[model samples]
Target: MTLDIVRLLELTGWRAFDVDDRGRVLAGSDESGSMQLVELADGERTDLTALPGAVTGRYLPGERAVVVQHDSDGDERAQLSLLRLDRTGPAELADLEPLVDDPKHVHRLLDVLPGRIVYATNRRNGVDFDVVIRSARSTEEHVLYDGGGLVGEVAVSPDSRYAALTVPAAPALSDQLLLADTMPETRADALRELTDRRAAARHLHLDWLPDASGLIVTSDFGSDRTRIELLEPRSGRRHPLVTSDSCDLSGSLSPDGATLLVQANDDGATRLALHDARTGAHRLDVEPPTDGWCGHPMPAPVWSPDSRFVALSFSGPTAPGDVLLVEAATGRCHPLTFSAAQLTGEDPVEPTAHRIPARDGESIPCFRYAPHEPDSRTAGSAVVIIHGGPESQSVRAFSPIVQALAARGHTVLVPNVRGSTGYGKRWYSADDTRDRLESVADLADLHAWLPTIGVDPDRVALWGGSYGGYMVLAGLAFQSGRWAAGVDIVGISSLESFLRNTAGYRRAHREREYGSLTEDADFLRAASPLNRVSAIAAPLFVIHGANDPRVPLSEAEQVVAAVRDNDLECELHVYQDEGHGLAKRRNRLDAYPKALDFLARHLSG
Candidate 1:
């Protein structure tokens, strides 16, 4: 039976929020910014939408409401109001009237302490982050951390004596954490040292010690290894804690700061280890289940509120993801039982792995999800789903989109291709610089290899989002006659244009990956799909978020214009209020139907 897109769209997941320490639930569904607070004791829900703009969220610790002042559709227009949620009622605490009026921007509340709230105002020009210390009693506002370079993960010590700020250089650049005392202008010195050091480290993680005497920083050396170091802010002395050549340690310090838990990969499987904060000694190791591919350890381990048990999402080569809860001290794990009804009603599609030889005779691992029907002889249409990050890998998971497509009598093939991580570091770095063309070749090679695995070659469609979106257009242009239809969502058409208009955080990094726009001008143009738009023959469906910061809306517009100039069968859909990806339930419901219709029209029998 074919899947009903309209009926499935109605079963949307409820917008749920994490319950606070006090058990108060706060969540919003739409862009209207109206936040609803649910009191767990009486099961009573209160609506808080009386503010000027939509309520982004309410802060913790003191239960303060933070609302961004905006017009209809929740567009940022500079004004931000911080209201106090007290027993007396919701009262205005601070009114920030028009800091900088930039359309479709975001003003996020970073931290809220006793008398101040640190926030950041980000526009297209880069994030102008500021530590705004505001008080309701007085009108004094203090600007602490304000400058450039991607600022985030701002943390203030428990005693409020020191503040630690992390500034990410680029996506590829190692992030640096600057620690400073609460005194005025203390962060200025740390920021200057950070600028001068120019740390080329790729991954950096930070956590404050128990007494706030020092900080524990973990930096990944990128060959599937990491080093943990402790830094004393006062003396500037760095102490090396632990170094693992194969295992990647994840998870931060415990809430009580008594112990630090780390998830590491050992012998092609994941194992959780507990470490002593002061001595850096491994105290306990949690052994995962013997079955399945446990080598790919989860990035972060979920610790319980009381720090008694640790929860992790684990999956094997053939099985779907299952949650595992383990005792913190004993390292005993208990797998939670989930029925088909509880997890998913969709039938499981068996995945068969194959090693396809690339252009350079290198074997690229590909996974093919075949239809569950008994009659395998019936040649069915196929969809090639490419994953984003070009650096990320396609793992076994319950994907609603893949299941929906398979239910409609179509085969789905998700290829890891070149540059995808998990296989090895060398395999990932192969697609760097001008090596993106190799990824394009891998797609075409995967298409040719589909027939041996029971998929009809002629009835194939290319589908992807983000970098995958770029691949969709690239496939339609370079291998025009191969696919019947293509779907590109927030993808790039011209690398040159993307380099000029991408988000500030990624501008330098992407230029390094694709090739510097200033130096390799001709090479960037050749790699772009816009230059080869004339070769595209397949029908295309282009979707983009109007306020997308990563790959700007102009990327979609330029591709659609090229398709129109070529007189190709192309349809463009842009959501005005969304950014990067669709966040609203209504937009997602609308997009899936249009996407299915486009693919059915072109590939379905």
Candidate 2:
């Protein structure tokens, strides 16, 4: 019988990203296969970007127009296009024109003001991102600051007099806030550190308290967990407003600036609460229905324009993410979406969380899903899917891929290895630079652990995307004889080339996670899979997007070539209309069947 994998893959939903000043929701959904812009208003849903490929969009403040990032296939470099949202009556064709037509470099819109637009681009310095300020009224633009890899998050004052920039301090390398003049006529130094180096290394600028009197930010200085602090940008004064026991704190100050929407992650589950931004007193708790994240547009608690309700995307182990409108005053919750109820398919196999100890005796948390029917393929065969972001943890989010694999009769285990997030800051930073390959070692622990669960050691396959894809390669390279087959989706072949060829916008920060080529080339070379591809004994299914900006096509191309040269079983599938991951439904339908067939042919021996 053919595996009905496509039906399982299609039963997932999206998280809300952008909400304009008018409170209309803009989400990137794969309901139609490709990533299309969706607008949610008055409980009515509309597909805005009905075009081809993936088109991510953000609202331009007053609901005037939307700035969308569209690229050819999966190439990370995108052209900023303007889709007029203020059109009246019968919608004319959105004459999509380039907002800032620099298709060669990544243009990130930081702050959009009435007359000025602040953005960052590496057009000039291919090595570092530079802040560029362009006038909204005209095509004229100028450099705001050329600080090399220092400037990141940008916050503007309500008066439009100044802009607060987050700068990474050297040596200690902590995040510090810096102030810069925004007024065109103002003759200031343009940029100056707003806070001293003694401050926290990281500060998530939440929002400028009403009238821009103070800035409320989440900082971790002198604390184990992040806490909200109000900072007097000009005077360099700071005071704590809210704190957490251990969970990472996030949320924003209300538009009225009276109450703070506080959301903290307790063991990867979000707990929502409201606190007085001024007094730091707890108002009420808006506990999340499930113990999962508040969803995308990561600042947590995305507030509506009126601030009457906070938009939250909550998910569970079984349910895909759905919107929740949590009333700010009473902390009472109302379900804004019934879409999560629409996901109907096979009997869902629930995952049980396990604290399996690795070879080093360090506790590794993972979620294991067992098949209902324990036939030969179901009992003996298994697959381990690694979450990408060596820093990102494998949380119990709504994952159709995991469920689909279990549906196809494979016991699935997702391990939160040494370098995953939601554990703590230390574990999150443990596998940086040279220690990354050790994460591949954690795969060995997973490989050994499978036998204890009745799965044959030889029947287990390894699969992952992005950094997880890198892990898949490392598994087949270093631990060759263990996995039955390896599925690499947009994974890195060489850590060195990834650091060099990745889009300029993501290169520096990515280097922070995976070592820099300038300083850690020797160690990176020793850890790369390209040098060890000769050892891969298992069948390999390599998949990549042609426009993948993060891992790049060259990584997939070279690895496939090297694998084929080794006279081993290898399959390479590239989707010309996808990027990074399989964002389109059509591509998924095409690719997943091939994957299911590949696993069945290799694992059912």
**Pairing residues by index, what is the TM-score of model 1?**
0.75
| Angstrom error at residue 184, model 1 | 6.4
TM-score (C-alpha, index-matched) for candidate 2 = 0.89
The most accurate candidate by TM-score is 2
What are the models' TM-scores? 0.75, 0.89
Q: Candidate 2, after superposition: displacement of residue 274 in Å?
A: 1.9
The parts of candidate 2 lying over 4 Å away from their true place are 1-3, 20-23, 86-94, 114-117, 133-137, 140-143, 167-176, 184-188, 194-200, 235-238, 287-299
What tens-digit string does per-residue lDDT give for candidate 2 at 1-605?
A: 22257666665466666665455677656677666777778777776776656676666666466676776666656566667765533122256745678767767777666656677777776657677777655689877667777467786677766677776644132566777775555455677777666653467755887688788988766665677898887686889888767777765888778889887765555667899888989989975554443433233556665677676666665666666667787888765565455554436677777877787778777889898766565468999999898757676566777777887788999888877866655566567667887788888987787778888898999999999999999999998788889899999989998888877656766776677788899988889898998998888998888878778889999899999999998899999877798877788888877987898888884
Write the residue-wise lDDT of candidate 1 on 384-482 in tens digits: 898888767776544556766765667888888776754545666678778888999998888878787667788899999888999999999999899
Poorest lDDT segment (10 consecutive residues) of candidate 2: 290-299
What local lDDT does model 1 show for residue 460? 95
For candidate 1, what is the lDDT? 0.63
Candidate 1 weakest ten by summed lDDT: 32-41
Candidate 1 Cα errors over 4 Å, as ranges: 1-4, 7-59, 62-105, 109-117, 123-141, 170-173, 184-199, 226-248, 263-345, 348-357, 361-367, 374-378, 390-398, 416-430, 503-510
